[model samples]
Target: MCSPEMSRSSDVDVRRTETRHEATHVKARRPGKGGACGHMALCHWALVAAMLCGPARTQRPPGIPGRTAENDVPLQTAAWLAEGRITAIHLPKERPRRLYFTLPKKTSAFSVTVVPCDVPVEWSLMVRTAEDEPPKQQRTYKKSMPEVWWGNSRKNIKVYSNVGNAVDTYRGPAYAPASIYVVKLQSREHSTKVSVYLQEGAGLPKVFPELPPDPQVRVVGVGMSSVTLRWPSSPSVPKVHQSNTSLQYCVLVNLKHNYRGLCAALEALRRDKKIEEVKRQGATLWPTPKAWKQQLGPHRKDVVFPAPVPDGPPELPCVCQGVENTCTVSELQPDTLYYLDVFLLDSSSGSSAAYTGTSARTHQEARPTGTALRDSKPRWVALAPHGGRLLSFRPRGWPPRALLTMQVCSPHQVRVTASGQTQVLAAEIVAEEPVQIWLQGSPSYLIYLENESPATVAEEAIVKIQASSAYHRQAPVLPPLRTVKSYSKLKTCNSVTVGWHGTEERNLYCVYHQQLDSQGGPTGLEQCLGPESRSDTERAVCKYFQDLNPQEAVSTATIGGLEPGTAYLFDVYMVRRFGIAIKYHSKIVRTKKDC
Candidate 1:
């Protein structure tokens, strides 16, 4: 990232460079239909040349001594440009041009863009409010079909690239109460024609509307390393006025400040960033009120904003069952104090509300092995000496394998699948004696058993089974064996339109954006953007999600806001039942150079 001071210096250097390349361009005369420009066209270009650089040819204006184009220089260095007009300006190599605009209102915002005629452009479009220059430096990319790179600094907001960035656009706040803003185009090594489109409007982010009320959250239960929480899925709003806006949830724990205070502080921090951006880029045409600025932040130097929760466990997830707002935070330390917070986020914009949270402590590391009677008892069955019985194995909902431990109340023969794999040991049908069996699968698995032969057995065969599972023991569920596939629909400099194929007909699939590191790819979980990514760069954004059941097989989304010449990973995840996002497929796409 280039600093503001360095970017401003680069803007100032355009002045000295422009003078060395000062020259006039005239249309060559071609005798044909709609022929070359006439004398009127020469005068018009001469006028524009007079306003920008170079001298206009005058017929010595009736004895005006030495007032000829031969020695006369341009009368003006900079010209007055107004809004609501499109101007096509030509910049000579190493030369730059500056145009000034007068804002109609004191609080008007400004927008400017340059449309280059050809590729591999070296000219930059810079807009400086309350200053005199164009700009360059750090680049942020966003695009349509033609990719555009933009730069923001303390002095100006510029739409340009150093080498080959097709940055011809900028819309941002102008300096407040200042009537004049400067637009300049600087060219390096190449002369080019760029059409400048300009506009003005209100572009500041400082609206203080009423925020919705917070949610009420409570601790549902606590385990040694996990805590279950429940709260209202949404705020209690009137049915007639209730919105269908989807909300995102984030839980913060182990903070120095209380949940409410920390939430307020975060809000203040966001406003502070907005204020800084506005002031730095001249993004506000009006100054923030003194009281508003003072009230916008915590305003305490001693109060430190803590870093994000460290790399210990998985991110806290808010999974909704139905209308029940319940979630479990697992993989926590036992016997540790925790300060919990649940933030209800409404939109991609960082606006959120932190509900009041209840602090809960986890159980100690060491506890008695067993004491109280079991809430559920395994059913014991008596079998005839030669009888065969088929028993079902219950699944542990959260685990990949449904595991059951069997204790032989009496000698018995048993056979069951292990870890979804077939491992037969001491099977009465295959072997002879009845031993123990372990079965695993989801929903449930079937355990095959038979009483010992009459020659080896005497009394009836008995067995007891035990297992641990999620809160509910459900019937087995068979996941689709098919695969999800992704392909590029269109590729551009700063965006990639992608489509997916071959997903389960009944599955819901979501696409996620992952910006890869420049070298090869992300090295660890800290840098990945998949569902398991803990990186801050992995935003809580779902670009495209669809129920493939009712929709067409191909769903596409043009993912923008990507950097030029960078690679990105797009992941397609199938949302299995119970809100589990199982990654089905991933595609690595690299964008072209914006030039």
Candidate 2:
């Protein structure tokens, strides 16, 4: 007689096969073959029949092969299998098996793949939730047999079969975090074996480990629309412990409406004397913990809880990662107080560390209405060759000190004098350009510009002057160069053509080239060429052009002395007034292998 476990396994197979045969009215039979069980005696068949006809069988249709009640045999339960275990089960003819397990609270999904042994077998799989509702059924093989082949030419040679395999995935409604799930496996005819592989959770930890100690965090800057935060680098840990680990950050913003509501609710909860009654009424209004740090156990000390925002709403933070030690949050309300909490996440182990909270208030928007610096447009001044133009005006409601700005609108050798002073405040004798001068002690001033060029007096030129409060002083603005192009039209093995437009003044233009590695990082063969050179190699590689006309906007330079069959990156920039460098464009070029 078969043992209780063996009997139950056979019974499960009988019920499943009977159900399938009843629906299709077809029976699957295995031919007598020479293999593992080919030499079994008649007693073996008798034992299988007895197991199928035992009390476990329930009344069913006359033509069906197995008892219906056999499907109810209690399943073996086990804890979640660890990451690398290959669980297997042996199923005899007509028997089915069931397994129950629980998923971790952080587990989002689970998957299982069933690989059958070398035999002809039909299998059916069903997954049900805790509620016992069978939402779907997955079948691996239907009316099919494993592929068979003979290993040798001799008839006595061994035969091989390719067992069927199928993968079933459970997600969302089929399985939930921290919920119970059931998986049932049943085989139709022939006694066979199967190996089950399961992957639980979405490959992430449900709970993170504690953070290391003494983390420092601070607010670096605040503005009307944004706040900048900074923190020290995470402490270094052993590679074995931190491999595959990454960090992510989150920031929560409490809207104005929610903030006010939470503050009022907390105050009311504090004043209520009957704690039980308040609790019974659902004290959901209580604030959440100040930060995730409070959730860590007492053993961790490096992290500190952020103080709750005073009279402000509970925090709803926002998060970002990848900005080493510094992160900026924008799109904030003007003149508002904000509480920020920053945290660190270890992705591999699902561990997190948080910094102490910091708070800052944004400044009110600046209003420049009614100020002398507002709406001041550039005024045009004409100068004849070797002649000068003078203008005097008092700026009303001006600051004690103001910024006087002047730009030559046309090509001219211009000299500027202020307040009748003999000293020349600014001159652009070499090239027409913009100039800024600081004026103090008086709001009224005389300004004069003369065409000091040796050209004849018949030639005419134009200049524009703009004066404003020093608070309005802004960096010089220049139009960006566009349509940057790089090519090797000459097909030279060691040269490339770099061209661009939009040069507004006699500013110094430079082309920098560097050999780059496969990852685009510099390989230390960096070289720069321009109108000015600070090194011997730069002087040898660069060509100088003097007194370039602004109207001659288009410029191109040919760079040589490059190695054959090499990749190089090039960028161009201009040094504007006051020595401000502005990058215009960049490109990559690869040289031909041979000339």
Candidate 3:
């Protein structure tokens, strides 16, 4: 039943076997031709050779001569083999192939290409030294590639690929014998192609330039919640580079609402209050003070200053340091709610802007309205000497005075006692007549009195004599206690200049100065500075701004050495000549640059 093709394949296999047997037999019969074990070893070799040649892929056997299984294989299977020419051999049993190749001195990263022959099969690749040890592994691709596959290229290896459909190809990194490195590539595909080369190096990147700086402006006249703003010309602006820009300043209060409008409205209110006058020039009816008069609302002659208005009166200068000058407001009642606003007139803007801040209420004290006094009965009188005593008074009449006499109906012998002494004097009633008598005592004095009533009778009365009572002449009342008002200036690197002003400078000329924090608020830090505290040569009482705090901003400061312009706080006091000393007030001052 065997076909012709199957029969031919068997015949060829049989003849090849018979030829191997006859050759072995001939070698065994010959004396010197056989191997050490004679024809028996030769027959074993012949049978192995026969089997390898019988329609199967041949693999190497052990102990072979002139052929080895370790060195014979396609480039795809032995990718680690170096770059130059290669020699290969095959053995029947132990190993299928052996490979050898020369390597170049230098190389770069490389890759491999592969083309499969016959059946597609999965394979792994590895490399190592011929002598010993496990092989080093390279890259491994998990998925299958096409018959003609490409690999990662490297600098040194130009190109490598499968040579023919009959043999499998391998590819990998560049190899160098100097380093003895190995590369490997394997795939399940039938074929693949890979090229290796070196490209240019990566360079550094560029950077972005920086932006311009922020503009700056000057700040001045800072107050509780706002600051006066002023700025120099913008350098970036054309032609107007050095010219000052006219700008309206705004106050940001708590980052909300525009306070500038409130300020402006207040200013407008002041402007409406400004009074202007027109006077005759020479013999003409022209305005004399041309610059003084402001235009009126309409068809009205130029309004005159001190002009009366519906608000009851004209503007009157509240003259300070002068008397008889009256300031009046018609609508003002006994106790009305009102506020005063101060203003500064700007000639250029013709605007009367309220002074940054100056408003206060009018005085609340009642004015005098002269009236008559009512009569009252005199109280009981004391007959004490008030002697050498300064605690009694004897009023003679309505407007009590020194020399006055009075008559009363009483006992002729009346007794008076004071300071442990008693005296009896005759009392009499005088009719419309005056008499003067000098009181006799340690502190002697005189008095005269007369009765205005007619037809009075003579009677005994106690003529009590005593000195004027010391009622109004009491211990001087002290003013409320206040913090000392002192100011300091930096004089030198080691000292500070102190200054103070007070009302009692005449009687109690001494001033106590102490350093305080910048806010003019107390620092609880103080030092004395007055005649008693100063050494010789310094005046007993220094000027308001000359002394220094020992532990001041400087050692011995003068005004000039302080920060060109800076604020400082100080405490000052006044020592009275006789009464208890007082700390007058505390103050703050900004040191001027030139001071």
Best by lDDT: 2
What tens-digit string does per-residue lDDT give for candidate 3 at 378-410?
Answer: 111222221111222343343232221221222
For residue 352, give model 1's deviation from the true position in Å. 6.6
Provide the global lDDT of candidate 1 against the true structure: 0.45
Greater lDDT among 2 and 3 belongs to 2
Q: Which candidate number maximizes TM-score?
A: 1
- Global lDDT of each candidate: 0.45, 0.47, 0.28
RMSD of each: 32.4, 27.1, 42.5
The candidates, ranked best first by lDDT, are 2, 1, 3
Separately for all candidates shown, the number of backbone clashes (residues 3 or more apart, or on different chains) is 10, 20, 68
For model 3, how big is the CA root-mean-square deviation? 42.5
Runs in model 3 with CA error above 4 Å?
A: 1-474, 477-506, 512-520, 523-563, 593-595
| Ten-residue region with minimum lDDT total, candidate 1 | 143-152
Q: Once superposed on the true structure, which residue ranges of model 2 sit more than 4 Å away at CA?
A: 1-17, 20-69, 72-206, 209-341, 353-460, 464-595
Residue range 245-293, candidate 1, lDDT tens digits: 3344555555234445323433333435455443332111111112222
